[model samples]
Target: MLLPWLVTCLAGCAVILSPVSEGCGPGRGYGKRRSPRKLAPLAYKQFSPNVAEKTLGASGRYEGKITRNSERFKELTPNYNTDIIFKDEENTGADRMMTQRCKDKLNSLAISVMNLWQGVRLRVTEGWDEDGHHSEESLHYEGRAVDITTSDRDRNKYAMLARLAVEAGFDWVYYESKAHVHCSVKSENSVATNSGGCFPGGAWVTLEDGGQKLIRDVCPGERILASSEIDGSGELIYSEVLTFLDRDPATWKQFFTIRTESGASVSLTAAHLLFVSKGNCSGGEEAAFGSMRTIYASDAQPGQCLLTTVTGELVGQNEEGRKGVGRLSRISQVNMREDVGVYAPLTRHGTLVVNGVVTSCYAVVDEHNLAHWAFAPLRLLHHWTGSAGGHVGDTGVHWYSKVLYWIGSLLLGSEHFHPWGLADPWR
Candidate 1:
């Protein structure tokens, strides 16, 4: 009798909350069809098509339009090397133009390929083509898509190229063909402000002062607890924060939550890297350190061991409080979340402790240490120029960043600096 009464009450509540109903019955309500309650009309002026046509012209489009002449569009030239080629440069060669964001990502993709592989050149097969080859709603029409391939012609190289393209910050990367990797960047209005792997705002970062702070509250010039070595030496160090990236939550997407067996968990972007052990067990400091590798949050799986620090005083104090001892904690779960703002504080050592878990400040690259070394020049420029505090979204690649890219290009022609040489031979 009690169960029946509860069920009837729930049914009545459901009917009341529902937007529409089939018909009213004797027991339910009245024995007649009832219309939904109409909402009060808003006090907005009604739109008139004739007025819109008069103001916007007979074409029914606004006069202020974004076109090739818009500032958001840029003309790209393959000035890096003969390795970077444009498809059909002689014909249909008006200009290789794309959105500014797309152009920047394309440049990054080309530079990454040149830096990652030896004797490999990237060929831009398509850019901003409106020759009826793509769908009407394609990003190509908006100058935000490009199709590329490598000179090597290896299918394996193409797959790696796609991965690199993703790392280079393309919004969407697809291996459209064995020969080409299709990459596209989201429009400025549709994309998030953050450019790289980042942690959600709630993640805790250890400070150099032996205190913990939210990652979003960290700022440039602040020192944070970091580690230079992965081998279980139990040696922890303090590294200066170079930049703090706080992403806008409105357009930000792609997040994953990694929960360890020890109850340590952190939510971060998919591309963010976390130190994970190769085996299932913790083999103490020596064995665990050697077996640990950086894995992206998107690729992390259950049962994988992640490197973390235990809360008691194991190592002696260095200016700060007691040092944390490194330990391997097996992962219990990896899940995706939709609502969270992202933040990342890039430290000098390229490693930071978040929510008691040891993770890399760098993303997309498996070799965290090597990636930090490769970007040393950029970090140095930021330090020297004091431009690290600039917001990624608002500024869209600060002037100092552009200057560094230009310097790298000039130094590359002279054969003075080679990033490929920095890769670890053992790995």
Candidate 2:
């Protein structure tokens, strides 16, 4: 099953193809922006990503097994490419359930975490990548998780929306710098294969759908679930669901910790926004551009989650600012972002992707922390940016342009100067 040839190409086989400049991507700016396309949020008392997967019945990218009982869970679509409106499913995946309680949580989070200016509408992509993570990380088998992104490919949304998620009701959360959110209700341990992983007592639960079996375990009493991260180099290891025990229903209803990745697991939602960068090994300049692609997993699998990466064509870039002569491994994710941010733009552009605060490193965003001033949701408009450039005189996409773009939108996207429904074109 290992495509060695493809892997070799990805690992620097050749640079024959010319690098093409794709057009600019969607940006937030001042003006009559489009109506925020809000879809029905996933509700069902946030489960682990694995639970969300199993509930959705996923097998892989476009194939799955579904059931009527789990169809409602699958109805909530994550960020996928097609233009979908409402929570209804046509081109995307949906099979989870959200009672009135779940829906209300989402609506509240949307308003509470919204930046008023930067994040007008949000997209939820890969809410449930169904079996996307490695074995032992499948909450879908237990039915508890979801992923959400902005429909407009907004990176600023990742930081703030992640914060808002805690205000809703979720435990195990992982934000991708790659423009996607992977969440679950049950606190999970993703480092079963790592050295710190202690699961000798952990029992495996078998989840099989369409030729896929998810290997998982349940922790009884108190056990550690850890997630951590290594800085700068993108070595992320952040744990959620620490000190959780599964045998008793009473304790199950209570809060417990699940140890995440150690050393490198900084936060569960580190990769909240997806960013793309390409540099040739042959001593050349790196070509980094932010491109987004969306996929829905709930459709194929009605109550299962299965994630597998696909092979993509290459478009290599050499140091000479020219594209050609190398095999470019294609990579894509929804709502991804760059780890580093420069202050030339909003100075405080959104990247903290959470509506809540970090108690420990891997703890979920708690509602209690949402109101803190230091823990405030990110802002797109700072005095420096406002005085520097308006929308017309703003920087496009270079060296983390999302910050600058968000700043310019203080003029275009925010409603600070006007009241709702007054002169607000976006309202």
Candidate 3:
């Protein structure tokens, strides 16, 4: 009886010390334990290789065709007030890719048109065509052309759009039909319709005979004042006029008027080159003229010095009278002019003085001598066959010029030859 009673007391003590019973006891110090939370499995859709091949072709890669169903075919949002819409459905996905430069200019053209006519939208009908829709030599094949149309399709509206395209820096712009306006940027593989640099009518050119003639009246075989030296020295020389080019008035829509502090001013196209000081220096004439460089008329800035000339009477019988002396004049203003006709005359030295300002007949190349050397072929062709050279009222660029430009591209390599500006990366 004693052994059984002892065993029962020991069992009761063991039960009091047990962890499961102590945790279960109500409100002693522990609370009821919570169960672990269960998590649901992630849902995933199965990959379909057939769907991928159907969208991206059997190669499973983009074949340069922007389909209407593709996410790549979307509206371009420019920083301007207008939106450029590419209607891929209209072309039925036949259009290929377009250059970024072309797209940028297209946006600019849209903004310009919208500013003129409020709420106007520019719709791109064709970007690049691989369906043999355009001419064999069309820039569209090179991804440099775009066909645009608005909702109105009015003739007047298209005319305005063409003008705006020119102003927006398109190398070529045409009103193809009542349907669309065609615009293109310059490409390495294509020939440009117009040479880059040209001047306007009413500009004055100093003759070798100490007299000045209107640039429009100046003809081939005439001698004009030019300088071979890059520095702003008054060492004037004469160079024979090789070809006089009168561009189509409709080709140009903008001109820049560069006015100097000495009350001298000249109006010229944006691509025309002029001798400007190295930087914006407020030094004296001698200091400013010490280092001269060539820059575009559109790039000219006020307070910068320009190479000019001052006419003075002959001091001796051996010297010619009314000779121009090189002087540096600070630019007062650079304004845009829209009322001017385009004229560009190629000279033997590739440099000329116009309206008392030292300018270059050749553009694209900053160095006057190098530019003259590069165009040697065109000049030689003109000398041999006068027909291939420039003529009055001839708007098309000569075949020789196109050949020379192509050769230049070959020599300069593809990476450095920018057809749009003819800019040399090395310079």
Candidate 4:
């Protein structure tokens, strides 16, 4: 069962993410953490009369959980190592979204490579496992990286696996320990590079909405060059607007993933603004807004003018791109009540500068960067999240969308897009 496997694996090996909380319903991924541990937070009534913000990962270090998908593929080999899966050891590569054919070939290839050693069972270490906290570079995120392990004199086996994988249409293969191997493929370039290089195609992405999407890139001074968009068929949907601009996507702390005219799918993060904001200013990435019992006036002096704010209790679209009204009720300070406040107001017409919940940091706020400044101060109420034993998978709740794009999530492939976009003819 994926559920038990998810739980045990998460608690044991650092493989997959922890079990997500079941309240939000399937695909609604709030509680669905990649690991099994829970975040220590205060209940709504604990600290009202205060307001603040907290980071998603500020809770603690990565707990040992087997949440990655790599290990799942490993069990398919005719020669399965049940013990490896049972133990809380690192995995080789089982969780990625690899096709079955690729999987069969991989197990055989790994075994064949391991054949170089004598009397030693092959154990895997980190195939498709997520890149740990420090290094976000891995084929694992895309289901392409695999880590194979061994404990004997099999240098030849190590070389054989890496070498064979490249020959078998898989490229990036290398050895890193007395007991393991790492292998992956480049995003493009038909010719594989066993020579050991990074994935092909730099990070920026093109959409089909007469707009360009800057896929998640973290370079400090990188700019968001102008581009077009993708279309309903997931193809470049725009007329040639390839003229590049001096704007940087990083600077906006905001970028659009417009593929159609409906504007439904969008992704944003705080870092998307701070260091990446259009120009360059050492704005504090850490300055933030949080929910508490009551909203407190910004540390700014009294004369400072601020757009008034209303209680953010539901999801809706305002001037600031897409905003998420927190579900927590009593944003009280001290983790008591959902103490809510504007780290920076989630303004929509200007640059995004609010220190908000991690989602605000990542997905809230609009493209203009202007936060929807609150007319009223932040406040917490009991059951702020509004999901108490009543609504389960109900579509009755509605929200205005700021996404401004259409998405054929089921029928689209990512390759049809380009640097600018494809939103030209039919949406």
Candidate 5:
């Protein structure tokens, strides 16, 4: 996929790229505050994977085809997203399994290299394999690294590739004695990085109807064996499966990579699979706060909150065809900072329609413009006293306020005391 002398040309074409902001998103806080550094903007637009398309079974995000009873050497979420081409012939018995995070960094490098040399293909020689050949301390065993061959025995090309990989968020990149570019990733989150990714190769079953029935043994042809990273509750965070593979007992036992709905490919072992069917007519699973709707009663009086029900689906209808519903609880206002006392009095009080119940609630608009309406039936004494400002005057009569002042001083340090804002009265 390349004409000769590509390394010499690329050797001088280096760009000092800056770290991309992964955390500190618009609504999120700035990560480990430091002086801002000037970033050299990329020449070509950096590639971004289509997460939605990947989740719905897009092709080519992987390196190879996905079908039943066929061998796939390499694969990504969708077909066209790959920038580097691997020399599968070199990786005879090497392991290819890796965490999704690792694969993403690799793909990012491929994108960078491809953009740098506009049509050249990268050939990967080795990836994760448990053949007892890799070192005991190797990140390859955990599926966090890969080795790629440079053009026609060019050692400097290997060094250049290592430099490029490090710029793409890979924590470690080294040229091995065996002549391949090795790169590894230390996860941003410590726990996930330290812990081994999703369960390794095994047999599993899906629980149905509260363990009343269990579906076991996915037969071939219909069995799209899947691997997914699940949360503590075991809900799908991402999911991928090998569609085209020689499902012979010998071949299927080995770990195959899968692309989640998010389009990120990850190595998952079949050992931890446990799907639970919700039964017919159960409407499958509903995401959290899925049915809740927030209507701004900025104009409505506190007791007689008027709901301008637009699009009809968000709010409910009553015996009389009116647009508004009565409040289920007392309307509360979300307050401001400790030193500052800005208020959203009119904008705060509102009635929320959640799962067909009209409740008095306060709406909190997030960075993305989505409103979070909270509803609670109970009200306590702390609700009236909670504030970012604690009146801690030594002569104050309010014991609750004094207690809060002391608590804030103790926890936040008295010198720079600022009480955490109370989002809701319940908290």
Candidate 6:
């Protein structure tokens, strides 16, 4: 009877000690918690396109991504900085063919150098598998070296360029007697050589097809005279005698023409004419004319004609001499009377004046000169006239007005004086 009474009391205690669900609070014995704090939106600084690119640092790397012996070396397309340019040297000519590895390394060198010199562009005069005259063991043959031209023709500038190239991480920097700066990267254990300040002899190897190439300095005041034969099909059969007169390449432009002394004339593409220091034949290899064909047209204006540059979309002025011309599309304008070369207002320096001034001026830039892309038009405008305020960047003007300003700046040549100046504030 005592045992039964004790068990009944224990059961009653268990019920009374059990925990209460509601009295434990909202979060299992914890107080109410607050929601997560909100974060403020980030503020970013605005920058112009050029500054933005520069701030991002080098667009390429110095390391050769493609190994020297790898098959990919031939197929690789290396990413290169836009500021670097490739040029043909006066004596050595230009060689752009390079392994993918060397191209990246070159772009890296260009970026590092540009960091030190503002508005400076690197011109790679030579690269990759040049003639055997350089040396069988030369890094250039292996696509590990390049020849860079100095910013200015001054020897002091060349020295500065060499010093900066060394600072830019080039393993070998050679100031080649004011001609060009030679830079290379070699293996740590491999010995690298530079010419120092001494002038080297027999540095250039004769190009394999140098004999067959027609070398002409395409420039202003240059004339071409050609005589052609025709077949029964009325198509130009071949050119019998083609004569090319030499002119300074510095004066070269986009389109050029050749007229025979016998009143017969043919038009020639100025872009096809290669500017060389010296050579034998001076004409483009015509497709069906057995290396020389002359197209005859009565519309061919007889007289000394000017040539213009055509590469990519930009047609007028290319002082940098970067890419080769695509084709001679059409003769835009011509002046048969005036022997004097005139400037199409706001056009590039060498643009020959024909019939009359070109009504429009277009601003342009190539891959090498992209650093100036933003200011290309401004520079072209500044080359001649004073800045007119209402013309280019006026915030108060209508958006359509601004568009007209750019179009007018690009097309119609400048007039005597336009009321385009900005108003003085609080005047």
| TM-scores, all models, native as reference | 0.50, 0.25, 0.51, 0.23, 0.28, 0.25
lDDT of 1 by residue, 244-280 (tens): 5334444344467889887888777655777877665
lDDT of 4 at 350: 18
Candidate 2 residues lying further than 4 Å off, grouped into runs, are 1-66, 69-102, 113-115, 127-137, 140-143, 186-427
The sequence of per-residue lDDT tens digits that candidate 4 reaches over residues 1-427 is 3354333322322211112123222465544333432222222122111211011111111112233444544422222443222112444334433433335446665554445445555454544444462144444543344566444535555554444444343333454454555554332211111111011112322222212333322121222211011100111111211111111221211121111111112222111221111222121121123211111111112221121112232133334223322121111121111111111111112122111211121112122111112100110110232211112222110111111111211112222121112111121
Once model 4 is optimally superposed onto the true structure by TM-score, how far is the C-alpha of residue 315 displaced, in angstroms? 67
Q: Is candidate 3 or 4 superior in TM-score?
A: 3
Model 6 poorest 10 in a row by lDDT: 191-200
Counting clashing residue pairs in each candidate, in order, gives: 0, 136, 0, 136, 22, 10
Q: List the global CA lDDT of all models.
A: 0.57, 0.26, 0.57, 0.26, 0.29, 0.31
The all-Cα superposition gives candidate 4 an RMSD in Å to the true structure of 23.1
TM-score, structure 5 vs. true? 0.28
Q: Using TM-score as the measure, name the better of candidate 4 and candidate 5.
A: 5
> What digit string (tens of lDDT, one per residue) describes model 6 on residues 1-427?
5344333333332322222222322445334242322322111221111111111111111333334466635643433445876664533332564545456556676775576567776777776544554754566655566777644444445655665554454444565545777666543222111100000111111111211112221222222111111110111111111111111222212222333232222222211211111112322221222222211111234332212222122322234322222112123333221111111112122111111101111111111111112224333333334331123211122222233334333322223102111011111
Off by over 4 Å in 3: 1-195, 228-232, 249-251, 279-290, 313-322, 378-388, 391-395, 413-427
The 10-residue segment of model 5 with minimum total lDDT is 338-347
Better of 4 and 6 by lDDT: 6
User: How many clashes in candidate 1?
Assistant: 0
Q: Give the TM-score of candidate 4.
A: 0.23
For candidate 3, lDDT tens digit of each residue in 1-427?
4354334333433333222233334455345553322322111221111122112111111224333455544422222223766766645443335655566677787887787778777777787665557665565654567787775565557666766665565655666666677766544322222435667667888776677898878878888877655454555566688875335444433567899998788777655678887866552354333478777676789988886766662122234422444577899999875544566787776777888777888654345545555565555555655632566556634443454444444333332222333321221
